[model samples]
Target: MSLLSTVRNPHDLKKLTAEDLPALAAEIRDFLIHAVARTGGHLGPNLGAVELTLAIHRVFDSPHDRILWDTGHQSYVHKILTGRADDFVNLRQRGGLSGYPSQAESPHDIIENSHASTALSYADGLARAYALRGESRSVVAVVGDGALTGGMCWEAMNNIAAADRPVIIIVNDNGRSYAPTIGGLADHLASLRLAPEYEQVLDVVKQVLGRTPLVGPPLYDALHGIKRGIKDVIQPQGMFEDLGLKYVGPVDGHDVHALETALRRARDFGGPVIVHCVTRKGFGYPAAEQDDADCFHAVGVIDPSTGKPTAAGGGTSWTSVFADEIVQIGHERPDVVTLTAAMLQPVGLKKFASTFPDRVFDVGIAEQHAVTSAAGLALGGIKPVVCVYATFLNRAFDQVLMDVALHRLPVTFVLDRAGVTGEDGPSHNGMWDMSFLQLVPGLSLAAPRDATTLRAQLREAVAITDGPSVVRFSKGKINADIPAIDRVGTVDVIYRSPEVTPTREVLLVAVGAMAATCLQVAERVASHGIGITVVDPRWVKPLDPVLVDLARAHSLVVTVEDNGRVGGVGSTLAQLLRDADVDVPLRDFGIPQTFLDQGKRDQVMADIGLSAQELARRIVELAASRAPALTTGEAEEETPAGQR
Candidate 1:
């Protein structure tokens, strides 16, 4: 039987011989390459960590000896050995295994921090706690070299080194992040990756000297002392040693036996040691290795052989639309500089980066830093356009409030994935951008219903020199190819069927991505002899005065959005109507106050009652209630007229 099929847990893996370990690593890599290609998870990171993971399982007694994976996306191999191999088929699917580490999933997984630069802090806390309680078990933190760029990681490093505790930090340096890591730290890591051959020669010299006789032993010790002195002068990684942490390696991370030996030494030798393991991302997969941009960082269902995407369709996605528009705008305006939180390709800013290399900055997965940096860019008299995922922007709320909004900086924030981003699940959903950004003072937030409006609004956001403005666009294709009107404060009026006469009955105002669904509901309702007024309130925040005025004319008003019901655009509009004392009955349709599961976008939406059929039924029920109220009011008026 193959090593992968035979081994169910780490305990089983520990039983394998040193000769068999390479075959085991090979088996694990093949399984990961096949499984991830079919299910589509974090392929490159997992592929890179196979031998390292094997070495970890062999060296550390996990579930007892705490091995914390930083930014948990790379924990797939860890999961497989911890008795989750059978569950790999349904990886990242609804009700199956999560893409990141979850404490609920296993006892071995102590932290579920999918966000980068958080695992070290967790390791520090656990180590400190263990030290106080007099626990003997070791605490190992596996952090990527890319994650070192984050300020939080350094904060943890400082603390861990100062505490002088038994915390082993395995710096998995594969020289890539979601994209290739940016900043000074990434350059330092590149130097370390190149030093592994020299590191091996030093190890061989040390081993030979240790085996020598009495006089030879003293001479070897002197040579070792000199080597340490020479290392301090010449090594680039001396930064870690200066911080009170012992440094070992530039070790071969792909060689299972070498990694096992280094880890063993680090385990025995105490007080915060960083074993810098050098490995190749997309190591076994030739196609991924050939990929210069992130080595197929996060794949979506692809053929294992060619690494081409399996599913195919033709429609310009919101990301592509944004990329095309931004590139055109950058060409037109010299001051329009772009910024990203380590996402160039995902947010579709690759061409912009290529065109304006100096102007476009990929600020490593540090959202807060990106925002404040944009504020600084604005202060320097440049029009800074900051692009980031909506979920990630939540990390920089304080920066947006204090640095940008308080100063009234003209930073244009282009929020990508502004609605329910399916498949990635709760942590990745962009549903809360409107709800949270609405609370920010002096911030103007708008959403685009179609591609044309998305392009036009993005331009307007950059061109305007007022307070911070944001243009949020959803995932997937635009509803239609209609061009946006240049007017700033106007909302689009769609779904006005000329066949039916207009009535002051029900008005359906939809927000952003939900506009297309609302129009479908309007068409369905019209077929039932009820013509509903379907309007797209493109801009969510600064709740359009025209929407309120139109709602006052209608007897029943319903607001639809793909965000949380509480404090979202729908609730905001409802509050506005109530404050105006319009006396019109209102209903808000949106996502519920609970965490969503990962699944197909349309299927998930339907299950949550956001479909056209569901919304139409609810609207029909609300319309029917008006019959009793109308009858009672008319009868009372007639009686008063008779008495008069």
Candidate 2:
């Protein structure tokens, strides 16, 4: 059997000799490539962290000695060493292994936020808790160098230094978060890597002092002052040292023995200490190593040999549609500029950057700065388009509310992955954007139904010069367009059933990607002799006045969306109907207020009863109970065509 096959847990890993570790690292890398290629996960990060993770597991007794992973993308190797190797086949699928660290998976795992720059704060809290209990356990926080760019890392570090507790801070400096890490911290880390080896010089000085005569004790004390001066001249460890935390090497992260040695010293230091280890983001695989952008950070199912996707490409995604339209907008409007939070390529801002390099800014993993800075740009008479994932925007909620909306800046936010994004699990899903953004005053939110609507609505959003405007779309391929049969003000009528003698209209308000599903539900309901009128409200927020009038003409009204049920567009519109005194029985169909599991988007929707079949059944039941005679010819005639 392979050396890795024997490693059922950390205890089994400890059984291997030092000479066996290099082979084990090789075996683990090989296993990860094939496993992740099949499962489609954070492959590059895990590949880079094989030796570092092995060293960590070897040095720290996890569950007893807490080891936290920042962002959790680099935890696959940790999972393997902690007896989760058998669960790789079902990674990121429903009821399978999570792509990020999960506390339920094993005792070894902790801090499963998956958000960046949070492990250090969690480590500080854990360290304090351990100290209060008079426990002897250690706390090790493995944070990526990219996470250091976030303001939270510095906040935690300031407290950690003041506490002076036994906390081992391992800086996994691969120098990338989605893309190459930006700002002064990245530059400082690069300088640290280039600095002379200080540990070797310190060892030479110690030996020289030991070999001296009776003056050795006095000379050693005097040499300590000189050593500091020498360190200032050679290595730049002063930044961390000045913070009241001990600093260690720019050690080679791929060398398991060296990493283990560095970690051992940090573990024994009895105070906050940082061990700097330099690694390549995609260390093992040739295809990943050569990747310039993000180093293949996350990928779908691919061929192991070529590292190419196995499946053929689908229709143009919502991201690409936005990408193409934004470039055209940049060409047309000189005042239009773009901004992203370290995700230029992921959110389809690369073409915009390439065309207008001066106009585009990548503000590195700092969402708060991105939003507030966009507001500043707007104040200077520039229209800044802030493109970011809907989930990550939660980090800058305060900035969006107070800095942008309160100031009434003409900032446009392009939210990609705005609905039930399934594969990355509950934390990564963009399901909460509608509900959260609803609370922000002076903010108008739009959910486009297809590629055409996304392009048109995006233009409309940018045209608003008074307050902030948001245009959001879901993750996968853009749905086929549902052509409008008629237009009533801003609302697009996607489907209108044949006019019967007695019109019993059920207004189906479809939100964004749910338009197609609502159409299917309309067709199914129409078969039961109930006339269905499906309308796609391109702008979900700031309920269109035309919709209230349309609802009054209909017998029953139903709204379908991919966001959470509470406080969403449906709920807001229901309030509008109540205040307008329209006595239409309304039913809201959306994702329930619960943490959804990871799966394919379609499967997750079906599982949550968001499918057309389920929706049609529910609508039928509600109509029967509310007005049984409406489905028959006994209902009142619909309003005149000219009046509507």
Which candidate has the top score in TM-score?
Answer: 2
Clashing pairs in 2: none
For all candidates in order, the CA lDDT equals 0.82, 0.87
For each predicted model, how many residue pairs clash, with residues at least 3 apart or on different chains? Answer: 0, 0
Please, what are the lDDT tens digits per residue for candidate 2 over residues 320-380?
9999999999999999999998789999998998899999998887889999999999999
In angstroms, give how far residue 50 of model 2 lies from its true place: 0.7
Report per-prediction Cα RMSD to one decimal. Answer: 5.9, 4.8
Candidate 1 structure quality by residue, lDDT tens digits, 1-644:
78788788899999989899888877887888889888888999988999999999999999899999986888999999999998889888877888888777899999876778888898899998998999988999999837877888899999999987899999998877878889888888777776645565677677876786665667867887767765654457778888988888888889988899899999998788999998888888898898998897899888887899989964779899899999999899999999998888889899999999989998897889999999999999999999999988989999999999999999999988877777777778787888888888888888888887788788878877878999998887767864332232587777654454345367888788788888889887777766577777776778888877888777778888887776788778877877787667677777776777877678778777788898887677667656434321233332211110
Q: Which candidate is the best by lDDT?
A: 2
Task: Give lDDT for model 2.
Answer: 0.87
TM-score list, all predictions:
0.92, 0.95
lDDT over C-alpha atoms for residue 390 of model 2: 94
Count clashing residue pairs in model 1. Answer: 0
Stretches of model 1 off by over 4 angstroms after superposition: 196-201, 204-225, 482-489, 497-504, 626-644
